[model samples]
Target: MTLTQRQARMLADMTTPTPTQHAIQVRGLTKSFKDVEVLRGVDLDVPPGSIYALLGSNGAGKTTTIRILATLLRPDGGTAVVNGHDVTTQAHDVRASISLTGQFAAVDEILTGRENLTLVARLRHLPNPGAIADDMLARFSLTDAGNRRAGTYSGGMRRRLDIAMSLVGNPPIVFLDEPTTGLDPQARLEVWAAVRELAARGTTVLLTTQHLDEAEQLADRIAILHEGRILVDGTLAELKQLLPAATVEYVEKQPTLEDVFLTLVGAPTGAPTPTPAKETR
Candidate 1:
């Protein structure tokens, strides 16, 4: 078939790969607080529609990394790109394409669940804020408690609402920084379900978790950070392979006291569980 110049141009455009396609791309990310160098050099690639967990102990630069990616804090060195926009140079554009749900719920205790979402929609200047609020309330199962003040909500409920509010603009990438830190076992499970749902629905989630089990349970890939550097990054099975071969040792199969306690309490160390009056995911 003989094609005109316009047809050839259209075909080329259709086949071209987007230059800014990754959900997140960070190279040699570094940060310094006064004289202390927290993140010496770090690099990461988070693909679209996946859950990537950053695991680290306290002061391991997990929060710093999230802050830089979310455009909340500027990096002293390196580069971070979110949804094809440089976080430093295109801070506004990057922020417009992402949401950051911090360690604590950023809900307004004074407003009801519906009101909170409505306020966010209005702030973003979306069309029909009331409709969006109600729709979000329903989507997160907060319809029943939509009228109740946020202060009356449980820990899990607050966290759900907090996350739901972040989705008001429906950005493709979400940043969760130690989201379940202070929640009870059941509450943690609920949040885990929510995180799973987010990734399943094609939202790229970059979460920082202190608990090893949490990373194993929810992350499609995990990165272990120490002293501002990634010690390892891979799937759980891949990481396990990196460990030395198991040594032969005699051991009982009986559950330990902690195991029994956990089983009886119905809360597995991390990930998520528990029912709230209103669930949000």
Candidate 2:
């Protein structure tokens, strides 16, 4: 079947109230800004309860694609369906079902963490907002700092609070745009753990990040975007197979020539190294 047809079918299926199924579908999605095309007929599918990572370099349209899916931006062509609702046609419904955390944490600095969660819960019309706020605080390990002003929180702490606020409504679909960009290693791991817990509990996630390792570690499937187009889309194993074979090397010499070459050329360790010369007589 064509990608458009598949997306339509996926949308129809999601509306049926079935327990487990696809949570997002996109096909032939095209977007342009002032004659500069950002999304060139992109197609994607995200299964329910899975983490789907959109991996790309800077200016590759990853953020543009994500904004469209989040219903914050509209595509010039094609369609997208999220959680049984069309992003363009049923924009309000789509917004109601999803939460987004952009590259920067969006939180009210003057408000306390607990207050932020309560505000979001109330906005979502959840009953017993205070109770829901408490639950979110506990889930994100922010209970101890919940009473502190967001402005006083550390970067990692603020990020956790932002994510916790997003979960106030118990959204079934979440979009995290470089959610760990500024986090330290420990904080990044904490965020990853939270993401895993969400997926395990049946929440579908769509994340965009330049961190390939993060995508490799957490994503069930990944799509590489290059120059506003999807260069490849598949599981990590499938994508790895598409690339040239990689090799690992070990040497007895300290501060080897390969390491020096990499330092000067600024290439990753996985890239092939040139042969080194042996001592001459």
Candidate 3:
């Protein structure tokens, strides 16, 4: 094609709307820490407004991938685009388009839950920080405990608050790095609800978790990362199809240990019980 014709076609292609666009895209992503390589040619595409779980065992480089996409760490090789901005070149734009919630809750123990939310709001220079905090508290079902010190929050409640804080600016994408780690089964369930709410509200969530069930329950699509490469990527049903079909067998269904534990403790479904009032970080 002539150069002029090629330019016109390119412009037309750019103007045309795609049925769907990836919220996060990684191509041949590679990262190395000193002598030991961490990520080796990882590729992922997370659809907008869906939960994409990156499942892997320990040392699988999940966190490394997240850090690269979040612009917190530079990848040694390859390209990662988050929210349509290249992480390496358009780092500022990428940062503006996403939030990162690490494994642990980053709450200020001394601050009340309300205070913590407002603190993040103010840091982001959002308008009416108090109102924003209140709305977030209500949205995350933390309104009842809004005035309580974060130190007194149960593990699940704290995680909810932490995630709420991340949504202060309404960034289009969020990276949750093992958000349920170290939480009790009840607490994990609590966080799971929050995650569901995020996807429901049109937020793209890229969740990294080692827990197999977490991926099964939360992800619209799952990608298994091992030794820095994605082994398989698909919906739960699609992934399950990789193995041979199960034989026809009838067995009595048994209650899972987690089910019995939650039932025994009388865990509330609406919310997790808070830590004791006397408990402090």
Candidate 4:
């Protein structure tokens, strides 16, 4: 489908039952550390059950914004509402409504995958922690390795287990901060599939990442952050329109100078370098 069509579909989806309400709402959010201002009057509105992508270059305050929304760090200014609960005024309610998966897997190395999930279930006060653990183990396809210590699992397996643990309470909103950083292409796809499944099941997702293609693939709406401010916020096509129209180049002869440069330096010339894939949902 065309980018315009994709955006139209997203806007239409926002009014549906999937995202029944606004999962996250922010206004004039600003934060500073010492003398440096990291966020400058940031604002965002994420519909429930939709994947919202927060894209930015390094040092652009993407992580800082996610931290504030997740209630991990307090913002210096502005107010945020998650699931109708204000972050500052109703922190407990906000916490109860959201789950966060940070850049690194937070699972315990010594604990088996099942043990880790059981721990989260217990923390969430689930009625049957054992049952919840068993369900997640099968849902994430970790049943075979469920008894193995997390430290022994492959990187992808560990990441999946970490995310499964986060769902113990089944919070309506989830914040994923670079969730697929070091995995191979196949593993990355698996993570993406899992994220999509969650959204399909009516989970709202806020994702922060540097990977433009990932944003294009998953984000119903995309926000670009630059210098601690949102440079653009809209559907993928809207953001792409901020640049030139799509281009197609055909070379009939030999590899071009740009290709030679990329071959020698192992980096693209002039073209935007591909961002390292980091799992954050």
* Residue lDDT tens for model 3, 1-281: 33456445543443233457788888899988888889999988788999999999999999999999999999988988899899989999999999999999999999999999999989998899999999999999899999999999999999999999999999999999999999998888889989999999999999999999899989998889999998777778766655557887655556567766876786656544433223222
Question: Which candidate has the top score in lDDT?
Answer: 3
lDDT values, one for every candidate: 0.85, 0.82, 0.88, 0.82
Give candidate 3's TM-score: 0.88
Per-residue alpha-carbon lDDT of candidate 1 for residues 1-281, written as tens digits (9 for 90 to 100)? 56567645544443233564568888889999999999988878787999999999999999999999988899999998899999989999998999999999999999999999999999999999999999888877689999999999989889989999999979999999999989976677768878887898899999999998899889987888999998767667766655556787665455555455446678633333333233223
Off by over 4 Å in 3: 1-19, 267-281
List the candidate numbers ranked by TM-score, top first.
3, 1, 4, 2
Number of the candidate with higher lDDT, 1 or 3: 3
Model 2 residue 108 CA deviation in Å: 1.2
Clashes of 1: 5
**Candidate 2 Cα outliers beyond 4 Å, as residue runs:** 1-21, 244-281
lDDT of 2 by residue, 1-281 (tens): 33456445543443333345569888889999998988888878788889999999999998998899888898999989999999999999999899999999899999999999899888878899999988988887788888989999877778878888887778999999999998865556667877887888889999999998899989998888888877666778766655447875553545565456555655422233444445433
What TM-score number comes out for model 1?
A: 0.83
Comparing 1 and 4 on lDDT, the stronger one? 1
Clashes of each: 5, 0, 0, 10
Residue 38's C-alpha lDDT in candidate 2?
Answer: 84
Model 1 vs truth, CA RMSD? 11.7
TM-score of 4: 0.81
TM-score of each: 0.83, 0.80, 0.88, 0.81
Ranking 2 against 3 by TM-score, winner = 3
